[model samples]
Target: MQETQDPVITSVKPKSRFPKSVPYIIGNEAAERFSFYGMRSVLTLFLVNQFFNPTDNPALTDQANAHANKLHHLFVMVAYALPFVGGMIADWFTGKYKLILYVSIIYCIGHVMLATFDGGLSGFELGLLVVAIGAGGIKSCVSANVGDQFDATNQDLLSKVYGWFYFSINAGSMISTVAIPWTYEHFGPKWAFGIPGILMALATIIFFSGRKKYVKVPPQGVNRNNLVFITWYALTHGSQRKKGEAFLDVAKQNFDPERVEGVKAVYRVMMVFFFALAFWAVWDQCLSEWTLYAEKMDRVVNVGFAKFTIYPGQLSTFNTIFLLMFIPLFNYVIYPWFDKRGIKTTPLRRLGTGLVLTALSFVIIGVIHTSLDHGGSPSIWWQVLAFLVLSAAEVLVSITGLEYAYTHSPKSMKSTMTGIWFLVVSFGNLITAVVNGLIEGGGWWATALKGANYEWFFVGFILVFVVIFFIVSPRMKERNYITDPVIDGEVAANTNSL
Candidate 1:
């Protein structure tokens, strides 16, 4: 058999040097997020106003809210679920760059359909299906691609790079989310939808321009046993697995040393991923219930000098604003402070804190709703407090999750692990979907949420989930592998020794 040639290593690059493609990737992410959040921020209100048919009292049109709510969650589910296929296909068949490029074109078509058919249900549904194809397909690959650009050499930048990468995302989202609804209100849905489509095109163009500079990882197809199969192998075959055995420890008797280490790391990450479900479930309320809450509240803005009325949907942009501020503070100030104080401040630990903050945000909203139930009209700034808390949690759980997904997974399973990470979010949206269903049906919980007692749902149930995950988070292990892998020869030598 012929030997595969070694990849040529060039001279040492300076630490200050960032990847040539990084600016483009960051630009693409920002624009893509703008495309997504712009439409999403207004979707519920839009559906209730134009698309969904109402059967409730002509005055209280919440009769059709159930349909709109169901469809909204279904859209979220489809968007997150397809990543399973996209990530798996990328791992074995298409690789990240090609798959993203192909799906992005479809994404643009979805947006065009929205621009063309905002008044019709069928066209919107079709457009959503197309957008889901592109959005879900790209989710797993784009973040993983960011990690691909780094190696042992420039590993120092991963944390900050991810921070800024996330910042760019929310920056675009903040701008478009604040602007799109106004566009929809005045310029019309055609322009509102069309603007996002244009941004998606720009995102695609920027990404394509950087293709030559991207660190393209070759796809390892179905023939390889990825982390999922390895986990299965450990669970099914290893009876002598001991306590504190990093789940991959079960593989010591069956696999090589390198494979064993990889599985152990993957296992630890999966454990954290499971607990993360609560955070996402609670966090995504910004898309649904928060908008609903905003509609019921006052939105007259009087900022010191200038005053203008704003749409309730524009309130969602607060998250983007908070995220931009918090990510840097966490990256430069918070995490560093922890490390300086002899605390490891691991990803799981951060995730646990994020959940607490999310629960707190809900508590604030619940109280505000209670006040509204009393017929006292408070300023919209109350919701701003909630968004600030939630966005802080986003910086904690989300950006940390990005770093953890890349550094913790085995090289071969990185893309798949990324997909599974988002699958956790789908599960979160599923939680909201179930709640929406329960609310649609007449129930004690629904009655409480409906008639001004909504405070208990956040302060009671969601907070309980936060406490549960906090207890479990400490049990999940953290393997901080910031540096890249050793040479293949070194890995093979270690395997031989094992």
Candidate 2:
């Protein structure tokens, strides 16, 4: 697993305006993140304020909370789903750059609608749908395109590029979380959402301005080929044939072995996608119920040190900030330490750690909420502590997982892999919606709140799924090809799992 000699590696050089290119992308990412998160941070609050209750009555607050949670999950579900369609569009017709530009415009338009459409419930719902489509489309396309900038040669620089990317994202989150929440408190939704919409427009323009310098990979025409599908269909049917099915019916019928191998790789990744649903079920609530929980908590003031108010939604920024910090920390410290000990931080191991850590993070949250239910608000330090652990787990899992999927996936299926990643989140959101509905309908939430809190129930269910995933992850890693710069052109020797 460890090699002293450097492998034959290709270096992706910086473009002519290398400095400018990085900033442009980073700036665009930062602004776009701000726009997206800003709107999201306040969406639940807005719904609760407006449509959540038709009349001002304290008794109707529960109804409002239920409605807001439903809307939040629905927005999240659609947001994750649209990426599949957006990725397909990029892989087929317009390519990433053009698709980003087009979808971004739609995203901004959705924002504008959100800011202005303060009419009836129907108008608000319509606005959310538009924003979801636009935002989801952009998310699906832009993120994949970020990887398109580097290839085999410049792959080593990916860590650094992604580091900056994470930094920009966190920075944007910091501002949006603080500012948007504040705006919603002081000003109206129009002002709060309008500012983010304006920023999104600027982000789009900035991305397009740097278009000439970016590496633009045309989509691989694999899916467009009729022979591939015909071969796949034959293979599918052949598997269902009676005992002693003939190879001539499947293997010999216009099937290419290489294409078969590619398909197997894609399927392997998709199989692993199921495990991720549990992770997202826990992870995505950072924006939904978790924020609501935070809104209800006591805010700590450190007037002796620095005078400033802390918002619960702003705490999510810790994930991004820690991501930025961990990018360099892992690359410089952890990777080298592991390399010295003759250990490879395989994606499976990373993902497993992420799941465990995420579960632990929720446990901490459960404990804090338990304290709150016991007639006392917990310290903000508890939330911060959980964030620290969660962020560490995120570095191990989500970042590594993204790189793993990108490299393991065949070039033709890069966008497909991205879409699959989001699909896991979509499924998770769907599960969350179901759980929320059940909790609301059956009124089982009160039972859990009696002890260490009901949020623990969600955490426990997710952790159970995660433990099962760990049992299977070793085999999953074995199935994937190690597509690292250190192992160029050398396929993994252990491909028996496939």
Best by lDDT: 1
What's the lDDT for all of these models? 0.77, 0.72
Q: Write the per-residue lDDT of candidate 1 for residues 25-67, one digit (tens) a residue.
A: 9999999999988888777777777765433343344335555
Residues forming the 10-long window of minimal summed lDDT in candidate 1 = 489-498
Best by TM-score: 2
- Which residue runs of candidate 2 sit more than 4 Å off their true CA positions? 1-24, 53-63, 144-163, 208-222, 225-236, 239-252, 335-344, 442-453, 474-477, 483-498
TM-score of 1: 0.81
Clashes of 2: 3
| TM-score of each model, paired residue for residue | 0.81, 0.82
Error of 2 at 366 (Å): 1.1
Local accuracy of candidate 2 as per-residue lDDT tens digits, 1-498: 986997889987655323336667888899998998888888776777777665756566554655677678888899998898887777777787878888888888888888888656687788788888887887876766677776675667777787688678888888898788888778878888899999999999899889887877786543632334745576677765456753323543455544444555566676666766777776767776667667666766686978666676677776667777887898789878987897766666667777788888888888887776577777677887888887887787667767767768666566567777887788788877766665455356533333345577777787787878766665654345444332443224243221
- With a 3 Å backbone cut-off (N, CA, C), the pairs that clash in candidate 2 are 10-153, 12-153, 12-154
